[model samples]
Target: MKLRLGAGGTLRYGAGGTTDLDLPGDLTGQVVTVDLRHVDPGSDAGATALLSELIARGAARLVISGTDTASARALLASAQHDAPPSGLAA
Candidate 1:
């Protein structure tokens, strides 16, 4: 089975074709972990939106785990570019 972040940041899970899975509404002060095992590398649009929402909603921490750590980290990093300004720039 493969898990991927589909369009609009919807989580898709299953083998062959994927199906949308409902994500939690609020992530405030929560530690959310996203599994990216067996997922293909592609556009990070959905991931970016998800990361934005997680940050906007005050998620305590995000743990990305999977066989494809590099791709997962890259995906998260891409989302950082679209994140809201936090005045952390140099």
Candidate 2:
């Protein structure tokens, strides 16, 4: 995966591995968009880890978008059912 710094200071994640997607920098007020088209989160742990990691960084919003709406829904469902990130209220 790759993280691109957008013109508006938005951070975008392209398809890739954990190393590629690792927090590129402190999020602060940045908005993060994870391009999930080819993202294969095989298990709940993987999904949770992905979401929690992004959330923990303190982005204004972490947007997971892809061509596959079904996969997106599943990912969202998994996140909702699992434990929330540390800074977020459950």
Candidate 3:
């Protein structure tokens, strides 16, 4: 996984491709930018799992990246109101 320090304390994770990240509580409130459209299906589950784990361990927010920044922002805005993409009660 790649990591970069971003402006305003954001932690940019990926830009050109997709990757599974293991974020910790220490990074809470930090932005997690990634190219979701290119995320491999196999890695998607793992990435979601990692995010879920982070939430359980006390993470608060994530910032996803896409071809369009506006779309990414809209997606994240909606994401904020929804549950993490995995491990919800059925």
TM-score of each: 0.55, 0.50, 0.37
How does residue 39 of candidate 3 score in lDDT?
45
- Output the number of the TM-score-best candidate: 1
- Candidate 2 regions exceeding 4 Å error are 1-21, 41-45, 67-74, 80-90
- What's the lDDT for candidate 1? 0.59
Worst 10 residues of 3 by lDDT: 1-10
Query: How do the candidates rank by TM-score, highest first?
Result: 1, 2, 3
Q: Local distance difference test, per candidate?
A: 0.59, 0.52, 0.43
**27 in model 2: Cα distance from truth in Å?**
1.6
**Model 2 C-alpha lDDT per residue in residues 21-60, reported as the tens digit of each score:** 3464456566666554443445334544555555565555
The predicted structure with the larger lDDT, 2 or 3, is 2
Model 2 weakest 10-residue run by lDDT: 1-10
* Residue-level lDDT for 6 in candidate 1: 45
